[model samples]
Target: MMTFSPQLEQKFAKMLTAYPEGKKRSAVVPMLIYAQDEVGSITPELIDEVARRCEVTPLQVDEVVGYYSMLHRKPMGKFHVQVCTNISCLLVGGMELYEHACKKLGISHKQVTADGQISLEEVECMGACSWAPAVEINYDFHHHVTPEKLDQLIDGLRKAQ
Candidate 1:
């Protein structure tokens, strides 16, 4: 049987309680997030476990995962770096920033570092058009970033790991 940490179990319980009867499926997103935070990615076993807890089918859970950019099936590093390269950001050197990050980390998009400290991805709009060239390291958002700033951020994450 799949097991989550005690804290995650509590969080899942609390999340499920927030939904009314027959609406437990609404808890799928947060549950998957917590599970992924613990496991690094959305595994098939996690899909089935989340489905069973939410009273939904594994296919239903899989569909939810597919719909969200934040969800992933493959393993990622401890820090997942997402660079936005949407039109809004691209106009302001987002692609350049992404390339800089790739060169700095020596890894291409959707690839993890050898030590598994960081993973990089070029993503779509993060709804921060006003702050173009924004990047997300895990859950934290950094806006109006330059290559130098990204270097500091990534280096910090590496050290944190």
Candidate 2:
């Protein structure tokens, strides 16, 4: 059985209104974000509910989820730290910073902290090559991140939680 909290259903309804009468499918991305905002992750149950609400197939919703990097099929920590490991970032100490962060947390990239507060991942790019060695925690960007900066960023996120 699939269902959404009333608030989520309301959000979906409102988002659908923004599109043409038969174009509710156009709201898939934003609806997914709404679900993600409410549930913390884009679980399979949420996908089915989104599909049902949008009058689309579950496979269509799954495809949308897979195409978007921001969407997650599994649960993540409270703070998801995605470090850019692309060419520019790598040239600017991205690897070292990632390694240092992993060592500090005693977990590698794509692993969550034991406390379930932080999940670290190595990403290709964040479109901020000029700000090489950047990281995004919960989609908030931190540029020119060194090991010290990463530590400071983690500290701030931890405190906020």
Candidate 3:
């Protein structure tokens, strides 16, 4: 009942090659990322399966998932909007941007919209210091975002979806 396939096993094997010998533990994160990509969402069962495939404990796998906000443990909405609220972004009104997105969607940070189309989150950073107060929607980077732009983006995404 591991819910794994040969294709998944092959992917795990290939990703494991990126790490050094007898250091499969170092490959845990990548493997979990692969698992997450394959399933879209990480379940307790999926974590356990990744742990078995990577020869690590379930706790170890779960720990990695919990440590990273980029890693999704539960199912997210159609769009996952992660706003950077760290120091660099904060100085550029990242906090206000997050608040605006929440108010616009009527869902607080980390909460999915009622229609399951949007999920808002406050992340540490998005590595676009030049474009501080940025947001990543469905992994697409939107830099130097303003409240008006946020509304436009949400509207466009809703229409597209």
Best by lDDT: 1
- For candidate 1, lDDT tens digit of each residue in 1-161? 48899988888888999988889999999899889999889999999999999999999999999998778899988898999999999999999999999999999989999998899999989888998889998889999999999999988887787
lDDT of 3 at 95: 93
Top TM-score model: 1
Candidate 3 residue pairs in clash (backbone atoms < 3 Å): none
Off by over 4 Å in 2: 1-11
Global CA lDDT of candidate 2, please? Answer: 0.84
lDDT of each: 0.92, 0.84, 0.83
Candidate 2 per-residue lDDT, tens place, 47-99, comes to 88888878899999998898987788777788898888889999989889888
lDDT score of model 1? 0.92
Off by over 4 Å in 1: none
Worst 10 residues of 2 by lDDT: 1-10
